[model samples]
Target: MPYPLNHWLATVGFGLAFCILASGNRLRAEEVDFVRDIRPLLAQKCFTCHGPDEGTRESGLRLDLADGLFGELESGAQGIVPSDPQQSELYQRLVADEDLRMPPLDSGQRLTSDQIGLIRRWIEQGASYRSHWSFEPLDPTPPAEVEAEDWVENQVDRFVLAKLAREGIAVSPAAPPQTLVRRLYFDLIGLPPTAEQVDAFVADRDPNAYEQWVDRLLASPAFGEHWARRWLDLARYADSDGDLGDKLRPNAFGYRDWVIQAINADMPFDQFTIEQIAGDLLPQATLAQKTATGFHRNGLKNTEAGSDQELDRVVRTVDRISTVGSVWLGLTVGCAECHSHKFDPLSHRQFFQMYAFFDNVEDVDLKTGHGKVTVATIAETKQRRETFVHLRGDFRQPGEKVRPAAPEFLHAFEPRSGKPDRLDFAYWLVDGDNPLTARTTVNRYWMHLFGRGLVDTVDNLGVSGEAPTHPRLLDWLAQELMRQGWSRKRLIKLIVMSATYRQSSQPRADLVDRDPQNRLLARQARFRLDAEGVRDVALRTSGLLDHRIGGPSVRPALSADITAYSRNRDWVVSEGGDRYRRGMYILYRRATPYPMLQIFDAPDTTASCARRDRSNSPLQALTLLNDPVFVECAQHAACYSDWQTDVDWIPQAFRRFLSRDPSAAELARLRVFYDHQRQTLAEFTEAQVRALCGESFAVASADQHDLREQAARYLIYRCLLNLDETITRE
Candidate 1:
């Protein structure tokens, strides 16, 4: 049986204590890796004052590179010497007295005994320093051999099982066929499978039934709708210009449809990147390609009276560059906007260099195939704007003149011509020599499938990001993505086919206490559906979903109190079938959000979202019980069963909502609850029974016994729809 909503959330929220059960054996068996083990420690503790950022360095000491660790300081003392810890100034300062410690008293930093020991051991073992993991080229070596070859399905499994063998843990068995069907449907298309579809898969005797289903779902139109929702979060796609005005963008849905069509066409990711970054600059670009440039126009805009238009443009440019860094490079380049970055190698000038790439574009409207519908997109101007570094990030105070360029620390920026534009910068991002794009993209797909990323910090992969638990696996996937011609569908299909993703999500008794975060990948991860996904599942199950692909975003009904946040102070509910459209097609006003969506933690669309938080609260439960959309769903689902004729309506309801048969104990408990509901309804008058059943239900001439029975069924279906298992991806 599944736990209560709050209990399941506490166990699987992805916010639990992090413990690397798989990497513990490596720490005990091999020498410490400076890049994986030591750099993150020093980068977190010492890099602020002693590393990078020349403005803050004290006493001419640097711990970020090998030269600084071993070189003699201005005071004529070596910070680190080969194979000697006692004499190394770095180690001595760490072990110094409270008053003379390395970080000093006011830095609010202290090293633990274990951390100090790791440093001393590194110095004693020759203090070797290699480049950071994210900066290095992908490792070309084959996957390591594993003893449990029976569990291996693809190269991904070999790497995963090898780690489990080293850690002395058994890999979990595959999940049952019924459970796998539901998992695939939600993971691929963000909907629940019909009961018949689940039964067909469970009864199929063919060996390739799962793979065949995988291919079919990948080709479904709904696949684009599901995947585009994730990309839109990264693009910060919203229907309105955010701020007090909150004016609606009438043509914004055109860009959303463009993304959907591109994914459905299986466009190569490299070409996808080039198109969005500089599609309009392409020679004789088509209308569809120009529409892809809407990625940058999705940033929040401020048109309030007396607001600084110049400052607003600068802010939009900053968001574009920062989003590019996070989405493609996985670096927090925005941290260096005001001053030099304290953690990574990005400098203030480098930030402006990136800013210059997006500085020359102007927003324009492209008239679409639809009558008079125009998409907002960016275009290059005839006149060039001189770029300069902003002093202290202020547009009024210009510092040094700069040009468009990539950060020099990673790869050499090669321009197509001397006068490079955003097109050259886009090519530089996807170049094979660049280490971050492939790795970052691979990790994002992995995070969507698995609950956590190979590097747990999905948005930042600089020195400060978490180390990959399976470093070789990450590199291998990155290499394979390029080898596959950057096909997202093929890569995603490859992942689900692996045995690592097919493992049962049931937690092991031994691992529950030790590996609460499930970083070991001994089994699959189970998590709740995203906010849009949660609503989609309910509408699909109720048989009320309008399966139309795309159009203008619909405005669902909202209460007066909730609609008061809108600029117009009211909402016009969509008519007919549009009222029951998918959650992704709902209008997302920045100032006035849909209460159910906001209560479930939907992104406000004010900034790029890497990962959304999953929280459980009384409000969520209350909304599920009382929200109009869900209440209508319950009414429709309850009507599907014949309360007067069918003796097994209770079992049918279970199969409809959960896509599975209920256990005997569950059936018995639900029967008792149903009986009590009927008894309570029996005491009400006929008019009261009709009022409770809702207007849509036919209760004009209702027999007393049948009215109470139908009302009881409605109450029972509502209880089932609110179940934790109904909303979770298991």
Candidate 2:
């Protein structure tokens, strides 16, 4: 049966009243800040039609800019009149007739009365404008004080606690040592701790035990393997060229390995970004840098008969533009392709300007056949090419010529004397003044550690994206990234060490109603393990894992039916230890991913995927029970230790699988299960026993009794592995 949902709800409900009573002190209305309160409201309600795009600017009014908002509109009325809501055209339109609403009746956006009141109060208190919170230069301000000063362990905790205090929400206490250690292991290395390791940490009296554990895990090679999976999602890393035939890119594994190595070496984040974007363009670039350019080569390529090659090339360029925007800038710059960005500050011209940086990459047609990486390494030509705006995102319909440039919205980092190239464009991204890169990078890292980001819409931090729940906290992290010289490891360590990150995942009863999403950071989030992590945990617990780091992607056993999708290629399952490599090394065919990973929500790798969906289904349970690999794991785990009695075995099994000993009640239920399975195995016929043992039953009839005993043990192990807690990271 599925884990009971009400169990968590009941816990959350118990904490609600206490939270409200504790956080009763609220901020007054007069202290409203424009960047925090007003800009978000205006960006959501008015920016789409009136702010950025000149072509789409309605009635020659722009609320995004101070000059535009305070100046008279084409209708000879100021959008905002200082200290007078009656005279402010913007305020009047918000409360205007339904047909004459500022967003208009059909726009599907309407300001609530409370929101209108906030806007009115702002105008009444001398209307002021500030740069968009994300675009402003990051300020390294100390965290604001909170009532729970004793709870603060770092600046992160201070920010989190300050927000919770304002919301009248009390922070959840630190999770138990056992739970904290397990959480740290999975969060850092994407693997569960061994029972001995877990016990040692729990018993350690050292105050810095957790920090030491975190540092050790961070330094482990596995750290790169865990984080590389995240970067692969953004890189759209794949083993095959995605199309009807599902052709393979054998050397794509080179780029995957590079990522793992780069992360493991703790390469500065700024250099990491630069290398991936224009590594080949670097003067006297190393082989590693050239391989880094494989990020661009990771995009899907079409080689089907009679395909439009020119159009396909344009699509590839656009893919790079869109992916870079989402991965680095946290904006959907692609939205401005056809016209102008309706909601963001990017213009149609600016979109092409960014596109121009990637336009000059020499197109190479290297498709030999399926299962081969044609151009494993990228080579950029020194020759430059002019780019034109595709009038409606159509290559044939060219409009205006454009030079390479960053988006104009940031108002930072313009090209020097001559036209900037890809390297210059990349340098500009990390040049300290550009606001979105640091914030976007840190936000994604935060999301990987926590279940949610400070800004919920990780890929889109523009006007249309969800406003940050803790804007100041997000800025603090962004500034820290730059201050630490863009060292991803340092930033990650700072976040993980915070007391806020150490909070218990268990929710207070009151939190369910007030902060259902846990946006206020009242508690840590408990989520099911990612597809790779789930598989890794089982492998580690069962003693079947191959700890070898990286190499060519392994082709795990897949049924012939699934491999048939690749018409021109055949998959040969890797032999011996290769079959048990980490899931990140599993061969990822875009058209047909490994069935187990696909079912568990692994990205298809057709495009940049910022976050993956976590889904649970009966099929997942069935797969664990019946899949051959999982069955093999269960059988191995069952035979791993020789326990003298059920009492010893059951507790040991719990420790191996869950890093915790079973309770008396759990032991009682498992004892009954073990007894029932043994009883059933004793009655099984010879053929049935052979089927249960599969190919491993090569011994003669003399060992039949021993085989049946092992089969019974397999049944018990399967049950343990399928437990909800076994596959979840709490």
Candidate 3:
């Protein structure tokens, strides 16, 4: 190669020109943290072509790095001629004729007016480049202290309370004890405490009682069910697909139950993620491990007519990438599918590299293994689903091919195996240095306990994410999670055992005026029972709950119209079948989700739902007051006591349903109601009263069920079903 004197002269001139400028204004221009500023912009706008793909280039332009942008291309054109915006090819492409948009066809979301201004100013101001913030090695010590020393509950509280102080907000007061119990119970076990359970805890003289409860709940089998459901939703648990109505994955629940068992077992979170992603790949993967792989296979399928089986399966696999990222990484990597991420530190090419990890495996029906093949944990029977850059997220239009690689922004740590695949994919995700996996898992666990994540959005924690209310708190939890060997149960117990977790929900009048949302947690967040918790309580109190454990999903009795699911749907609410007797698992059969559940807020099975919104609606009232399940449970509940024998029926009923001793006032009102209802029913035959409770005459109970004796019991059932205590953590 000839060293040209002219080239050397030009390079020296360029270096001198930059030095002259630096001499005039030596203070470095606003420190450009790539992860904080530039990486997000580059990642969002230019990573697809000018990025990691060594395979292809369009029009000889690549904006991936400063050298790539400033150096000459094969065509002798440069992306940018620094300090010459008019001469720069890069600027021209950005503000190009719509027909030649730099992002290319159909990748809309061109740079914002402000964004364009930033690029123009930076380029004109001598465009220096830097590393992404996340890629920089971590600081072992916490950053300088923030605010009020007294306000800081822990080092975590110090960070968060400081942020609040800066915003002129104050942390909320401790929540009331009732609300605290409800919150803790649901947080730990996905269920609520009985009224009696609440009272006992409130009366306990022992300070250790709450701590013991948290421990026991974590150990309980029900704890697995509660935590398992969260993981499953992320896993996309579903049992059927294809034209033959719903093709049942008869044993799909096995995976669901497996997750429950794992959580209850307090398996380390690192091992937990490894098992699901590469469980079947383990040298000694047990039957349980193989079933855990079902988590990957749990996503829903579109089995309708004319569907492209292979293509659909591929889309599902890609979606799996998005799900895995959001659920585990707390990042929105999905945005990079077509071009680049517009607001985060991930390039489109890096996305494809990650995509390559899951590219090779195929999806086939577990049932037929015929017809339209589907891709999934197919990585199991063979290899994990393979990755490929789906052009603009479309299957048929092939673009440049890519092999698996981690996002470029994560330069600090790379996957262990030189080759990228699902197992390597699994490894990179939970690697100790990886920032997101530990953070995401801990955030979810926190959200479950506190009713809000320290990072409230829970799923999105990228450039677009909300600044964490308690950055130190979240980091502390993450450190503790890993410190405990990634044991989820240990992390959960630690959070619950914290002084913040046990604080009362009742707001101090002065504090209430000070803090509104209670981001500071002057006390715990008061929580309303979720649909599952609410339904479970009603059944539990009324003596109607079917406690049989794990199998398939449940399908509570529904009116024929709801069951028929069509224009002329019949309204047939059945009571005689096992559907009413099986546990929550056996209640399956998609056409009709138990009506009670639907009204209370169960998400549609058609998609994934991480949070169920708590809403108080008129429909909730109607369902409780009139539903056959409620009526039946109330009847049975009344019968369980000494309605006509040893004790007063109404008071006994009150004790069983409300778990309260019952006031004289409540008993008197029930006595009046019983006399009137019995008189009205007495006029009718025995069949008439029997039919009223949604039961057959003489088919179940032979007595009038002691209406006088049971009236208080029915009242209690109705009251408990609607109690603020029954549905509330407080």
Candidate 4:
């Protein structure tokens, strides 16, 4: 049973983790010496046939729980005389069991001789049970400590340096200026620096050059475009509803833009979270804030004809709730949906409890009168979720009635408010006691800036998560997050300015051997550029990029064949068309994604994704070399080369793409291409040249599309623009 959707979020936050009987043993079985160890060993071997389950519980005993192990058994004799191996009844039963063997059955799965020896060894060391290390929190002070006069920055470094120092290792000094600049640029803005930007920092002699760079990057509008994208990916951003009928939601660009705006404004992280979760309910929410409500709406939807939309909607809510828990809390609360969490502290009841919080908020139809909108809703009918236990995860047979509540692990969170007041729910998440919310948020920031979180699993910081490399640093960052009134920008600036973040990705042989993974932040991790960055970089370098800010999304030109293959669509490219050049103008369709993005790890947006997987694949190679978009952008670059003017167009072209003058070698190659193209182009008459240039040329000896010289230049220019390094952030 679940609580009503119409209620508030407070219900689930309070008492979510119910105290259920813990299912697993609190300890592992102790070992025994051969005969003495043999007693228990025999029991394990014998227990399966006589184990704790139904058709068994054999030998008038069970082997499952501790209570059963000690209880009276058919063999009796108190199972074994305590501490007397020779007198143990179970031991005698096992070795003598060939005829009356206690195991009762033996096959290929029987224990080996070494196991019997280990059991004998176990008996020597008295058997004792202890829980897994993770269930409990660490002591106030870890046994280890790293104290460095200058290498350390925060407690995180202290912990890491302490460990390394204890082992006689040392962290490298600050990286050089070029490495630092590139690190900060990519970390905060998700783009590489222009050569000029890099040169400025390296050339600067100021001690505070790095700090100034940090401030500049965070303040730039590009910061939001980069970081909001990280958030959006986590929020499961998609342009269209998912599934067969996943039509593009053109207006979704508003939500994307809003996120960018929020980051640029340095909105308090808590408020940012609140706005995303329940911005619709915010008392003073502007249209942008309301637009943030689209976070929940960002998950998948099924709009196919005859699809059971209701089921899909509910699944999405569950996914949203699960995404929120995982993304913010680092708990796999979703695991408790059918049974108690097999490993963590969450229980099945808690899953529904949280599920109930989102039950009432509706994914309502936005259109009036039939067919007034762009896309239809997935579920044809809207029905309230009735509270019921989904028996064994099967909704058809509900077993228990439940109200919204929290999971058992954190055990004592009290929600001061109630249901669809999701705002209260959002507020509770931001509350101080909610350790998960802050830790997860900061860890995500760490992951974004450094390419990996101190706790590697950014989404799972709970017991199952890796112990924090710098627990103190993580805590300090979280505390700072709260102290600074949850300002994301301040946190980002702080990290970018840190010496740890500015290290070069270049490796030191010794450090490489000791810390090849670089999780310790000896240096910044080098990463290839993402899909959007690749496209954006091309356009920006080509001087063809339109920097005009927000408006309706621009529909980019696609190959006629590619467009024809999907939805029988078409896109015409024009030299000066309204949306021909901006990278952002490209449509992010749902069902039929553009090949360039699809191959570059773009999320399907059908689910809330906390991370967009970065994959290295061969297809990505083909897309860059052969994709129509790259081809067109390349052609656009070549358009700048005016051979008729007799100017050195290659150097000019290099400036547009590389942001610097070309090398003499590069200039030589372009000159050669130019000379060859012009000589070959002589065959074409002036009219044909004009025809090729998309203009009328007065010519005698020319092909139909006369402007062969210009066309050849554009084609060659396109090739240079599509090179790997040209698009990659590194």
Please report the candidate that would top lDDT against the real structure: 1
For model 3 the TM-score comes to: 0.74
Candidate 4 per-residue C-alpha lDDT over 60-94 given as tens digits, one digit per residue, 9 for 90 to 100:
56443334444455655655344454555554555
Across residues 369-420, which tens digit of lDDT does each residue of candidate 2 receive?
5455444655555687779998878889998999888875685656655868
* Candidate number of the best TM-score: 1
| RMSD vs true structure, all candidates | 3.9, 5.2, 15.3, 12.4
| Tens digit per residue, CA lDDT, model 1, 179-245 | 8999999999999998889999899888898899999999999999999999999889999999877
For model 2, the local distance difference test gives: 0.80
In candidate 1, position 54 carries an lDDT of: 70
TM-score of model 2 vs. true structure: 0.91
Best-to-worst ranking by lDDT: 1, 2, 3, 4
Q: For candidate 1, which ten residues in a row score worst on lDDT?
A: 12-21
Candidate with more favorable, higher TM-score: 2 or 4: 2
Per-prediction TM-score to the true structure, in the order listed: 0.94, 0.91, 0.74, 0.73
1-730 per-residue lDDT for model 3 (tens digits):
1111222123321111111111121112264433345555765676555564443445545555557777876656667776677777777777889886667757664788788777777677666665433233333346348656654444555555555556565555555565566677667776656767878877887867877877878888888877776676566566554223555555567677778778877888878888777776778866666666666576656676787888766766677777777778777778878766655657666777776655665543343243442223454335444345666767676666677777645534455566655777777777777777777778888877778887767777776565455655676677777878998888877776655666666655654444555666666666566666666666677656665556555445666656667521433333443354423453333444456666767655554555666666657656666666666666666656343654366665555544455578656655555555556656666555545544521232444545433544444455445544455665
Write down the worst ten-residue block by lDDT for model 3: 13-22
Residue ranges of candidate 3 with Cα displaced over 4 Å: 1-179, 242-245, 304-306, 363-377, 380-388, 411-418, 507-515, 566-594, 642-688, 696-705
lDDT, model 2, position 516? 74
lDDT of each: 0.84, 0.80, 0.61, 0.60
Model 2: residue 50 alpha-carbon error in angstroms: 2.5
